[model samples]
Target: MSVSLNGVGLTHANGQVALSGIDLQVSSGERVAIIGPSGAGKTSLLRLLASNLRPTAGQVSLLEQQPWQLSARQRQHLRARIGLIHQAPPLPPRQRVVTAVLAGKLGQWSLVKSLLNLLHPVDMSGAAAALARLDLADKLFERCDQLSGGQLQRVGIARVLYQAPELILADEPVSAMDPVLAGHTLSVLNEEASRRGMTLLASLHAVDLALTHFPRVIGVREGRIVFDQPPATISPAQLDALYANEQLQVLPAPESTTQASVQIPRC
Candidate 1:
């Protein structure tokens, strides 16, 4: 199994219960999408899988090893095999795209080599090739701040692709892109995972995109797994119940505008 979460639960320091009773198992090369309303614990679940947040209850097994049981150095080594694409990538604003992408392998490189590479990118061609996969090859030398939001998201993904991890976790990766670009970006991610037999799990608010791109869909609501089924098997009624909010019904719908808005999880 690429990931296994058994009866997993997390409680924040401030007493916020982010997740509870999350039992999930994903095999190698499986592409899964997590969807639900905002504040429904989607991000928390992804963070749990990425080992960024430890569950206060239950066990988390990644790549057949219990993460919490591992030593700090061992955990660091394990993290090198996982790739996380963030919603807002934490790239340095003034850093060049090539340097940013190459930093993906810093965990695997020697400290001396990593510091040297920071001064001058060692694998320019590799970074460029990764960027080319996302149609951002032209921005290789541009500062990260120069790119648009969608472009920065792509750069984050390219960095992960360059890392070539065994498991890929993404959170709202395409939220900044247009519908067409979002579709294309997701296709690239799915294709890469399929080609390399890597495990992929992503949390998305766009219901249509999730259904279209991923074969298996996991619905999370109120910090629990409501349903885990194939895309075709997920019914509209289930989605409605997952995102239902009484407050929205009391309000009137806004007038249609020419400018398109990203698909929000409907209630």
Candidate 2:
């Protein structure tokens, strides 16, 4: 399936245009990274694809279904086929990690079964397996509220991993973690998405991370997609254009000028 956004624009309640005249496409099994400075509308783009927000103009389609045209039931069905990892892991605070992971299966399970799980809590074996994959097995029975930022994000990923959606949309999924954990999490996500042949589109702030993991990269600036190209082929000049003042500060400044200019590999 393909996620296509054509001339899509989104506006905020305060009359700010979050995204405008954007045209992008993600084919099945393509791992794309959207990279840009802060306030570049990365989250906005993700919301559009996830159908959490309707486009102010133009069209957004996933698997050939127009999001707004679908009935409530049909929308839910379509949403079930798409997995999203928010920048902040939004799990129920008091819910156990296993329960949070099991929430992923609610779409596939019957309503009665969903309600029953809410009460008795079942199917933890799969959650345990996913936790093991992320080296979070020890935290399975722990409450989501008690976990650290990184742990909460892992719990979120575990849920999506179990859901096995055809499309995965991640917005700064590793922003809260240290370099080591961030790399580990992203590697696991990218590997699993590849193994399952699912399309993965992730928004990222780390330039090298996106360059290292994703073959294709899209650069957003001021709510517009400024550049879309292969990571390896993207020039520093193009990066400078996208980030401008922001890029000079973040990118390797030149070996002679300052000690911080050196490139440090991060997770």
Candidate 3:
């Protein structure tokens, strides 16, 4: 599967332009990262690609289906095929972790089964296994409200794993975690997505993490794409220049040169 955007632009309800004349394509199994300052329209771009927003002009296509062309049912079907991870994991606080993870399978399951599982959570084994992949097996029965922010993020990932979508859209999936946990979480995501040959598109504030984790990187500024390159090809100076105008904080230099400690803007 693939996603293509041609001359696509988005303007807010109050006439604030968020994206302008964007043209890009994401192919199956490609891992792409979007990086930029806050309010640079990073989220807007993802929303456009995910078909959550209609372009004010031009076209947005996923696979062979046009975003505006598809029927409501078809759009839902297409969306169900893509997995999304938000910057802040938003699971129901009162729900069990296992039940939250099981919700990922709702798109494929029958309505009766979904309702039945919601009440009793019959397929705890699958949810438990998915959690195990993220080293959260013990938290299966824990309430979502009790899990740490990092733990909640892992649960979100576990849901995506269980859903097994063809495309994974992760918006700073580990921004709230410490560096060690962030690397581990991203590694798990990359490994799982690679195994399934799924396309992974992520929007991240961590320049270093984007460079370290993603093969291809796209930069946005004022709703315009400024840079799109491979990690190795992009220099630190270039990154610094990219966010020079924004008020930001650089991470403390890394302990070792062997590990990437690319500074990210605090925004």
| Residue pairs of candidate 2 with colliding backbone atoms | 179-267, 183-267
Q: Give lDDT tens digits, candidate 2, residues 184-253.
A: 8889999999999989999988776787788788999999999888765676667767776553445563
Candidate 3 lowest-lDDT run of ten:
252-261
Compared with the true structure, what per-residue lDDT tens digits does model 3 show for residues 164-202?
999888887887789888988888899899999988999
Q: Please report the TM-score between candidate 3 and the true structure.
A: 0.93
lDDT comparing candidate 3 with the true structure: 0.85
| Best candidate (score: lDDT) | 1
lDDT ranking, best first: 1, 3, 2
Which segments of model 3 are wrong by more than 4 Å?
248-263
**Tens digits of lDDT, candidate 1, 170-226:** 999999999899999999999999999989999997777887799898999989999
The per-model lDDT (C-alpha) reads 0.89, 0.85, 0.85
lDDT of 3 at 172: 79
The most accurate candidate by TM-score is 3
**lDDT, residue 12, model 3:** 85
Distance (Å) between predicted and true CA of 195, model 2? 0.5
